[model samples]
Target: MERNTTRRWARLGAVLGTGALLVGVLAGCSGAAPGADSGSTDTDAALKEDVTLTWWTWSDTTQEQADAISKAYPNVTFDVVKLENPDAVVTKLQNAIKAGKGAPDIVPVEYQTLPQLTLGDALADLAPYGLDEYEDAFTASTWNSVNVQDQLVAMPSDSGPMVMIYNKALYEKAGITEAPTTWDEFAVASAAIHAADPEAYIANSGDAGFFTSMIWASGGQPFKTDGENITIDLQDEGTKKFSDFWGARLEAGELSGLSTWSDEWTKALTQDKLGTLLMGSWMISGMDDYGPAGRFQVAPMPTWDGEPASAENGGSGLAVTSQSENKAAAAGILKYLADGEGRALLNQNGFPSTIADLENPEWLDHPYESYGGQPANQIGAASSASVIPGWQYLPYQGYANNVFSDSVGKALGSGGDLNEALVEWQDTLVQFGNEQGFTVNK
Candidate 1:
């Protein structure tokens, strides 16, 4: 185990060397101040290292996660710094690297931002870190979020597979017979529900992020590449199909606009005022907290127009920063989290596992009685395999997503034109790419 660990860190060092800035960024990775080791004894055993590793992440339960860390690695100590906004993590990491102090050994990078992190040389390649050992443990596709230039940088953490959670009791009351499988069927069912109850309709948010998910699931790519210019293709067949379908539904007054992922929206879910929520695997975890038990049921996301596919929503990966003096120790902890008993614990605590393990069946067995005994983890396991694959990680990912959000929002807004909005977004992405030192094609 020690020999293997050495080889992994050596390989990891070589990869970090490719990015010039990382050399300076990682210069001050050693020195950790000793603390009283206050978390879980179990995690402390798993790490078993005589060093402390700092982790920068986003989570509601820092103490619980820290406890779990201690439980997994008894010898290794972890100092977790929690930050909420996804963008803040990148900013903080970059600042730490620049300051040459207080940098984390391991960091959690969202899948959407993988490309940007890799391009900037802000993260270390984790290939030598026993990635091969844990590769097969994760669902095949979700595991690649951190793969850039063929080097694996992150361990699969959680995934968001698209699902439609509905109010079964509400459907019964409205005399609606079936859950929607396609856009057409969804519209029909939504109309029936609306007619039965004047306040009900399918839920929609005029948000571009949600639209991007729908566009991909509907068999369309948002930006087409010509050498390097990301041209707007939102007016393509897939976009038109999605916009026309949803627009028609809205115009028919069979829909109610609710802000996305907010407390008010969750309240509507409990009230059964919304017919369906097109969300990801993590939705199941929120159900118990938001709605009463036995009121809802889970179904596959409504299809756009083909063999049903889901848009990849939320997922996280573990990246070992180049600056960590203890790369081997970091890798050991990541491997345990991705493959050992840690993955199962993450799944049970509301973070769906991206890694496949023997513990999978055990996790799935604890059904959510709130969704009428729905085996959501089981469903997520299957759905993870079918996610539409091309969420191409971009070097300027944060800028691109912002552009996508803006363009899609404009297109979906009342009187918004899809073509004009997309053109503007595409132009913005090109400008940002060039400014970030990347070659942008015209």
Candidate 2:
């Protein structure tokens, strides 16, 4: 299973320099003819050029968004190709890059998968497109997630700042007056809820993404990557803290081990068999679809200390493929989708990553009928701002997620020691990373 580390690093080094010319032009360091605005002129010319960009996306691009992008760049048209899911897009994009052809001009890459793609040099550096100016446009965590090493390979599109969505009715029934602000309070609330109704628990701990996010929010540095080197430490203090706290609850039957997003989980959600859900702000958009309107309410995620802390659950970035024949045009489309008018349109489906959208008075104050007319965006904004920084995902996060059920998940229902499970998970990741030619340190 050994890979060519030397070749991969060489390719990445070359990719890092791909945007130097554009970077120089954008920085006004490119010596052009007097009174000649090279950066703007080049961008205008590229936008005005007749080009049809193919986009590979798992999420649907609204007709309004398409029309807006078209109006912005009349010369550019899109052939949107919808894939089944994000994983499918990743597989196809990887294959296309290896084949040196047949890749789309644009793709939506999940934040976790960006590292692997960048290491493989499959994406173009977007610094030349003046995207570097957008550093302040996004939340710090969201912005940092899209930057691999020094290269800006993608633009932050949507983000999933963690929040706790609870059933207000269920909480009231359990005699819990307010949402828990600390993990200690959460434990008490969990006991209260389970005692009130034997069938309902405070939350579920049977999801890999949820576990990873919990560890992140607890300030765990489970994974860190630098070029071909990686660090995997699943038994960090944060990891043990989360595992010990939740593991006790699982053993005491105060928490459910129902798998998230499964039919059974969905049934529990709709039937009010679950009291709270600690997930991302994106879940708010689908609250009504999950249960009766006004039943779910948003709250900041409970913290280890009685202070603000959060982590990202899910999100994606828009990137241009290196295999594209029309890189400039493709980059323009990405900008529109991520930073321009299309951003607002895209926000209709998910929580926004940009500061402008997050802080906009209208958006922040907008109340959701599904959330009992509460201004839930305020909670989402606060959580996004409070996300504990420096969380890093492994390059092979998809595989890590897939193997979680077998390792850490084995301890969930059985109430076994999660710290031991995490050690097993760490060993598995270390071996996988070494096999992939990475200098894995556990």
Candidate 3:
């Protein structure tokens, strides 16, 4: 119940710019650079206008956030629409963007979906409204995810820094007292755990997205584009080496062939048959809620070469849509959401991205019954700090992601030689790019 509830909140709206009709909507950013717009709009000037902006978000608390915003700028009225299904939100957004009308003033977007919403520049650029001023204000990677192709496209509301969540009781029963610090050590431990109890395994078989995180942790850049020149590399040393390790173990039964989040995985996790889960920090609340409690421990994810590294996962952002006739009002609302009362509302549900909030007692001091009273915020902050940068998602990541899932079975889907599957995934992406009219580079 807790996992489903929190995940719902995390899937809400984000920022980015768009269209020719959008040219009229964003009159201030007209003829602006494809990247950041001119940083000269007066946010206060926009706030004075009588505007009733619509916000499309997934959380039920959005109405509460809208109420706060309405109070902050009394002249600005906000209409908050709560959609229970994330796919429906994205579907409405897509329909609006394509028809060139009906899009909300602001909407919640997952960071991974920014490139899509902002495709052909359909969302409003926040830089002109002073969003870049807070560039140093958010965790670098989370901020980077919002800035598609060097432009401030969305305001990051929350982030999911990756970490290793292990069942402490399971480890103790397997005679392992410490979490592995390196992949070499991790593999050894995986073998030992399986040997100790044949029913136990380290992790699920996972999918392409899962491998993408692991690739990021290992310093691999799977997808990158320079305006027109796109580069695709899934067969990098790190990916190849990591795939080799896991593929061998999976075949040997050291690691479970179970898929993540499935009924099998949930039972294994609750029963302590699955020892460790390397995932985004958002999983902490789920672990605490679903598990027996006081039986979990978090550590920076194990590194490939023992270098300081980790990956990130599920995070959502907010953006101004092309439908808004009031850019100033929309930008103000986004800024307020990121740093104002909306931030508080966001914190009520998921992890925070505000720099000062990291240490603010109001944030860092939450000692909930979860984790047996450990200050989970500190652990979250530390995990976020360990993230290695330079990983980027392509503009067509959503399309490519689906294709990769079908082609490679996500992460070694149905199991053959995972390395060969990587090559196939690589070729498929390159082909998809060419078909989509991108100049595919090696």
Candidate 4:
């Protein structure tokens, strides 16, 4: 089945802003039509073919998982290429697509960057491969993130449903017995924790992605897109609620101003100077690297009104390139990784995205020695299920993130007014969107 090369190239040009000029040039140079696979609807026959696939990813695909994928599809060989980071993968993928060559057959794309890639029609649509049948397998928010403009462009790999990881020792020292259920309680605990140890704080602030996740958990629709028409409202009720609550605490020095993942931040974690971490479920795997495992405990994200609410922080999906000559083989590999035995192997090292894993009694109740033998997955599962629906990221979210440091980041670092910084961020996005030929509304 050969996909429409002309249409793919034209969409690529639209993303590159070279219009039909680049389209005509690439169409002529693309050689054989892309996705010229046998187009067999039979999955068994596709898996039997001897095909080699290049998988570009920033995360590790363990040898154990590789061996399992190999045994499942003996004829399929994978060339796993590890990149420096997610941004590197995105940059390389865009350049390869624009050049009409050198793109890998498979890539793990972050959920935030999925729309940016799909805008150029660079990934193969998986709906034809029976991927739509698994719609019920994932939560609505996780499923929606991988589907862009009604196209199932990627397979749900792993998700980052939000959770609160707190230092039990610090909470005990602050005279707090349990995790705060409401934002107001969290604020009070923050003050107590900081007062208990002048060098310690409840959490760190000032990362763009973290800020967006907080707004998302608070039920903010700050960014929404419908094709080329987008609505930007950083001043929504959710955004205001988050800004006002966190801003006051930040100004009072109840939260650390340290940037996340920085040397100082890691040091704070190692020394137990950081009391709590409001992060994604994926943070569970790395907790032991910073401090003793039994010292930390997982809890549901605190809510505005003492109700269950959550949002995704980081997650990615496996996507097949539209330019691949082995689309069927690539999709077969995706199916195995996303929904087959390979999924269980991957879940051993990360959080699960599928409902089967999230709801499994055994998986949810599995205890971790790091959290003092607590079943941390229970909290993660509840958070994933409670994620607010209708949350969306901009198609050009990469650009939005790059500009956040100058606007909102500065305010957060200085303990300035987050609400005003959000307005500035929204205005910048509006101007950039309109310049990109989008119908942007504020």
Candidate 5:
């Protein structure tokens, strides 16, 4: 909303060095250097010497991606460690950096975790790796999510742009001609769908996090600050209004109060029990597993009856840890992953790429027959362009999630009184921000 480019740059510069590094010291005994592998893709053979680049990633990569990387870059050996627990990754990373041993070269970081890693100084600044040159190739929002303080600390691999996915059959059954474009319309349309089918409603009505994501889409920031001071905005009128609307719907028995991001919700989605879902682009893969192929379609997220509106859901970025011995090599690896070809490779491996890889007509445009014969890949890519960027991802974003989750649980668990729980959550957030030395004003 702020169009003052020069002022925004100035603000970025001011906060770039605001946080102090927690700890950063590369560990472990002497390891193999870069280009040590020689023979096959095996570590021993590829490096010739013993070159092991430790990589910590949250989830498993596709076999196709692994095979391609192995074949293309046989000289570098990667000790890829898959993590089932994400918090453990951060904990282990911090401990390794502090102890000066067994530190990983690359780590997959969620957008929300940027502050945690960067504040600790465990991650490397990626500017030297030609980040500037490839910056324009990525979606503006995706690229800016990882580029904080004018420092490109990480390369964005994938992002979750909020999307409105609906069951065309359900909507038609409900006699709803068009998808809702505003919150009021969304509510009215949802009520009509429920009236018609008794089971139709928007996505899960029980999840407050889902509501928070929607609130943000309406141009409401979770927290607002004047650089030196922060304030909790959860109890603001905007949030309360959303809570009331969503809560009322649940209480009216017009919606299923299932948890968003849960298997139950997925079942509801696949079975077409819900009318529409405010989901992310990455959610497409699960559709094939849950719903019959080609059953749903995507529309823009319903607005807040206000200004330009959209909210990002989930995404991961690639960050080079300071512990990496081969920074250049690591950067090179990222360069391959973030650019057009690299993005395409990521898409091939199940990760959404911001770069338009469907430019070639020969490439499969319509990969799925489901969804009433729609070109999903192209539609999903076009949605990426509408996402708003340059928002602040505070260091204590995890705390914010905690606050939201607890508030929601309390509201649902205690007779649906969101206001009381929100007041408490707001206070907790203020305390957290202050304790972290972030500005928190009353």
Candidate 6:
């Protein structure tokens, strides 16, 4: 799951190349320099090169994936630097680039932040290196994430398809036989659960990221661009439908007004004071840690009707920095790391839905007590494919999300004018984008 509470997504904005201020204290990114004798040839002589590559990551991914990649290239050694802070990673990377020294050969950037990171041009475009050959190897959403203006910015690593997890006991207590298939049904369930137990809610009030996911699920295209000019449609029908639904629920006291991932919310979840949690695939493991054993069940997110659609929540990929001396070697490691075997190894720490692994028979085998032995990974796999297409993010999406939270998030809990709040958030984003040398659209 998350490295920490805020670090999980707050650093989603970390990809921006803002802040010219250079901090002398760089986060640790250590490894030995490459020796001589490395070659593209498969000859034994190439083994003598022993290229050591540094990778900076906040996710505590095990070394198995790195080790597997090392076997693919005997001359390559991976020095994995697993940090806990995502913001520090962004700072160290930018500062290193500014100073022209001390950046890691490879770094992980979330898909949500890739568009923002592209503005800096610090990531190497792998299209020139023939990375397009593997273009169809990953899913469409993942493949799309790696490309910005036809440039392959990074290799797709893992995916986090948005879904809902419910407290099984709580749902049963409220007479919910199956997961709510539609939003109307969900609302009915929410009302029933709260009426039966006034202390409980169907779900808690989440932040901008969660709202963005719901917007995507409703097929709302919030952010997009046509080369130079950006088009941001925050007040779309889908968004209005989503917000109005939640707004009414919040007013009726059927939904918890507490912020997601907060201590109060977590307590509610553990104590069965909440009914369901609308979140991403990574939350599978997270829910286990927060709730008592055998109390939760995974299900596809409730839809407007019965159509399958979702939003990508938290996913990351590895990008070779433009500053890396061993760009070719770094790309090789990244490519090897995203393959089937590498993905399996990576999935040990984080859920993966890469092209090869998504359909693997083993995906349906991993059982969680929280899911009551259900193949939750399979549910995540299916949701990954159902994500709404053309759902793009602004280059300054992190700043926009922050602004949305500051304005709209505060309004959501108190049954304030959510539509007005969104308008304010949109205006703030337009201003930010225009100031950052972009043509803003609304």
Which candidate number would show the highest lDDT if scored against the true structure?
4
Task: Give candidate 6 misplaced runs (Cα > 4 Å).
Answer: 1-48, 62-64, 71-74
Which residue runs of candidate 5 sit more than 4 Å off their true CA positions? 1-50, 62-64, 85-88, 98-100, 197-200, 206-209, 224-229, 235-241, 306-308, 350-353, 358-367, 413-415
The lowest-lDDT stretch of 10 consecutive residues in candidate 5 is 22-31
Candidate 3 C-alpha lDDT tens digits along 1-442: 9999776666542112235456656654442223222233787778887888888888777887778778878999888888875557877877766555677878888787788667756678889888788777788889988988667888998888888888777777778889889988888888888888999887777765677777787777767878777888777776777778878876676767777878988899888889888878777666765586577877778887776787778778888875567766789878777775667767777777777776687666777564677667777787788787878787777676677666666445455777777888888788878888889874
RMSD of 2: 10.1
lDDT of 6 by residue, 81-108 (tens): 8866665676677667665567787898
What TM-score would each prediction reach against the true structure?
0.81, 0.88, 0.85, 0.91, 0.79, 0.85
On a 0 to 100 scale, what is the lDDT of residue 15 in model 6?
A: 40
Minimal lDDT window, size 10, model 3? 31-40
Q: Is candidate 2 or candidate 6 better by TM-score?
A: 2
Q: Which regions of candidate 3 deviate over 4 angstroms? A: 1-40, 84-88
**Ranking 1 against 5 by TM-score, winner:** 1
Error of 3 at 211 (Å): 1.9
In order, the Cα lDDT scores of the candidates are 0.69, 0.84, 0.76, 0.86, 0.66, 0.76
Task: Please identify model 1 stretches exceeding 4 Å from their true place.
Answer: 1-49, 98-101, 223-232, 253-255, 403-405, 411-415
Residue-level lDDT of model 1, residues 1-442, one tens digit each, is: 9999999999988887766566554554422222222323233243564877888877766557767877756777888888876678888887766565556888988777777666556666677555666666666566656666577878877777777888887787777667877878787787888888888766754465566667767767765433344445556777777777776776677766667777777677667788777766777777776567877788888785647687777677878776676777777777777754766566555456555442367776768788777776666656666777755545666777766666655555554555566667767877777776656654
Ranking by TM-score: 4, 2, 6, 3, 1, 5
Query: Which stretch of 10 consecutive residues in model 4 shows the poorest summed lDDT?
Result: 28-37
lDDT of 5 by residue, 1-442 (tens): 4679888987887676443221111223222222221213222232334345677876777335645755667766677887775667877877776665567877888776776667666677788666667766667777777875557888888777777778877777777778777778877777777888776566565554465566556555666544446666765666677667766765666767677668877778777787777766776555666566656876777766644457667777888787677666667677777765656777754436456553444343656555656666554565566665545555666657766667666666445676677677777778888887877865
Count steric clashes of candidate 6.
0
**TM-score of candidate 4 versus the correct structure, residues matched by position:** 0.91
| Cα distance off (Å), candidate 1, residue 218 | 1.6
Q: Candidate 6, after superposition: displacement of residue 291 in Å?
A: 3.1
Q: Model 3 — TM-score against the truth? A: 0.85
Rank the candidate models, highest lDDT first.
4, 2, 6, 3, 1, 5
How far in Å is the alpha carbon of 366 misplaced in model 5? 2.9
Clashing pairs in 6: none
The top-ranked prediction according to TM-score is 4
